[model samples]
Target: MAKIFSSSLGGSLFKDERFLYQEFVPERLPFRDEEISELVFCLKPASEGKRPTNVFVFGKPGTGKTVSLKFVLSELEEFSDRAKCLYINCFEYSSKQSIISKITNFLGYAVPSRGISYAELFSKFVAVLRTKKVLPVIVFDEAEQLLKSEETKSLLYDLARLPEQQKLSIGLAFISNDNFFLSQIDDRIRSSLQCSSIPFESYSPSELKEILRERAKYAFNEFALDEDVVPLCAAHAAKLGGDARIAIDVLLKAGRLASREGAKKVLVKHVRASFTQEKPVKVEVTSNLSEQERSILDLLKKKKSQDSGAIYDTLKDKFAERTLRAALAELEEKKLIVSEKEIKGRGFTRIVKLAGS
Candidate 1:
């Protein structure tokens, strides 16, 4: 009988594959020292048992916003017992109730997931915070997910007013790819936030190289990557959008491809081959869009093009006009769709179509 598995094995390419994952935070984040310093400056007050300035961090994806803030949060919690940090992905906890529940749970309270009104849960959280008297610094990543509806918007309002209304000193940080995220919020809420802003620029090819080289050190074994592999991956990702995530993804895929072929090293050809196998940057961007944005894109895909009014009418049953307009503007900003002014019978209307259609 044939053996179930071959006795011989080739040299594996990866030393520790987890280093390539998005969730893995490195000990040192390359090319983001200035940003990290600014985060520390903004959040330092919490370590002194004071209300830290709320911060709004904006950047194109893969520019190190989330990871930098996370690193600082970890350091803050480690440095001082006065500060407690909680990180929440707004995409996963998009609702107001869910966010409050998470905070409650993080504060060592295990509230039931269901059978509690948002008001009750929120009050319980406030009570917990007041009793604990610890300054909580909450980081909301992908914050645009919280702007989809008025209900969720109220959550931001309440959070911003926590100090004034509940007398709790809390620090809030929002990370998003959208620069115009604040414009959609109510003026009162926006004023209450008074958040300091930090913008992260897209990584240049050289910058991406440094990032890839650092990640590769832990992700792959010695001599596992050919001389040109890192440069090739960086150049490709730079051309695509200067996204470090894409560059790392390409590197990981190339390593896997080399291992699959029993090749000792990941070569330029392996990187090139992985380009077709890896998902395009647009797909990655689309996967991160909110449900409303995805629905709008799907509609555009089917209709090819539609006027503002028509698109609104078709989707009005599911979303309000305000929500639709915001989602459309966001899609255009993301370059997922294109909008043009066209002449109607009486006046001009905007024509919306999928980008590159």
Candidate 2:
């Protein structure tokens, strides 16, 4: 009876919602200028007919690691034809053969799907690279998965040794959430890579606000968002891990909630409601913390607020005061705790407490 396919909703909140999507790469990434410059430095050599320095980019999830590299890769392609950029997710192509086959296909060389030996496939891939005279800059996203298998570990070695073995210019970029992944890799592979490491720090609350505001300008129409909505979303995601994805996703959900109710604007209530739907993401953030960080949070749970000096005194036997201070700084960065300076008699010290207290 009702028009099944047609909706009667009016006053939509979104103008173009794709800006909030993970797959959508914005032309300019806010708060990632340093990381972008470093990526360009590593990949720039390819444009000059020299082998690009291998780079390992590590950071927490949704900290703009993958997106920054993707943006750089796109710019590099536009600037020069000498660099052949190929992006691969190691979770999908975790084997040596599969990855090599992918590179071959990416270079416009097709091989028989079956009945071809890996050595033959690889030889063909190398020949194509030599003939094309383009430096292959292969980005392996989620590269931590590749280290789990001996098969894939060997693939790293082969790629690293390609210059010496095949006399071809090749570049490798690895993206991972685990900061210690390079330490787990083989020494020879590590030595050959001469890898430049770039670390992406979690966004601070203010930085997250800037990011959300920029995205909102593109995603929502004029006056569609309440003033408080971006702050609430940023604070929530900052508390978790300063995950930009969480902040953007909450904004998108809140906009949809407003549209579903035929509301004229997305308000703070919609953002709060969206928070209830992201408990799983909160658990994931908690589970991914280091044991030391978790221990600090557990200690903080017993008190409403504790002096930073006293906290160091309590955990001094297990950790040095410097290490404890660093842990507290990290916790504060994640918005897991808040720290403030206080005067203690003749001197000032920091007072620490769980966030939102």
Candidate 3:
């Protein structure tokens, strides 16, 4: 409490700070009325116990697609009890098992994290939906993240075929920033979804100003922010694809910088400085690293390149083959290490090394 009041920046600069968060969906969105209405209509059928038409929403990063869809779903849940909304981020849950497990878990079923076959897991998924007698709407955020594997195609095929297979009421909404997303997926998967599509236009400079001012009124003290701060943030963000998130993030970062400097108000200088502060990497954090992964990286850091069998031998006492393989896969995914499979006479030898080590 003491620290909260001791700074010259005041107790806080924000009224409802959550409005600036990526996941926060304001009750009323600025400049997105049309998009919101379209989304609401897209999900309206779910309330009547019918499988609503699937929707594919695409736009560049920081557009309002994700938030608007979420806002619609939130409102739908408020008045309807026959439908449920589920959101999944493909970048985080990329694997088939991970995706299936998340869906089943969201449906109130529990199964082992591994060793659960896709057939069995999906069987459980359909059974739950059938028994619940409720419409299930799934929003796949960054659907393009799943396009790298055939399993994703399989997943989409199964979901699109679910109604015919089980006669269950289910809906899928795919969101992607890449304009070419449709052309890249399997033709069959694309044909099956046949989604109602909507594209979010980029925000203009004037539009960004309105968004920034609106958020500022609720995000900061009336006089604690300089008159030029919002426009500066808006202009900077507008130049980079008119991302409202960038504008909001800049404003939030400026406030923190002002507080850190013991300044009474956030100013243009803080906004400029905030732009240089690199956002933290979200893909891999040291704490998320498994013991074996950390050990493997450490070993490679000292021992340099080593064949997979030799590396496995070095840590066989502490880790099992499955754990080692899984750790290697994660490390490779993180780009902390690189593995190359070399064809031998009858098989292949896997070589591992620290990337650029």
Query: Judged by TM-score, which candidate is best?
Result: 1
Across residues 33-94, which tens digit of lDDT does each residue of candidate 2 receive?
Answer: 98899899989999877899999999877799989999999999999998979999997988
Residue pairs of candidate 2 with colliding backbone atoms: none
Error of 3 at 211 (Å): 1.2
Location of the lowest summed lDDT over 10 successive residues in candidate 2: 4-13
On a 0 to 100 scale, what is the lDDT of residue 290 in model 1?
89
Candidate 3: which stretches are off by over 4 Å? 1-12, 279-357
Judging by lDDT against the true structure, name the best candidate: 1
Against the reference, the lDDT scores of all candidates come to 0.88, 0.86, 0.80
Alpha-carbon RMSD of each model: 6.0, 5.8, 10.8
- Model 2 stretches astray by more than 4 angstroms: 8-10, 280-357
Considering TM-score, where higher is better, how would the candidates rank from best to worst? 1, 2, 3
Q: Higher lDDT: candidate 1 or 3?
A: 1
In model 1, the runs with Cα more than 4 Å from the true position are: 1-10, 279-357
Q: Give residue 317's error in model 3 in angstroms.
A: 48
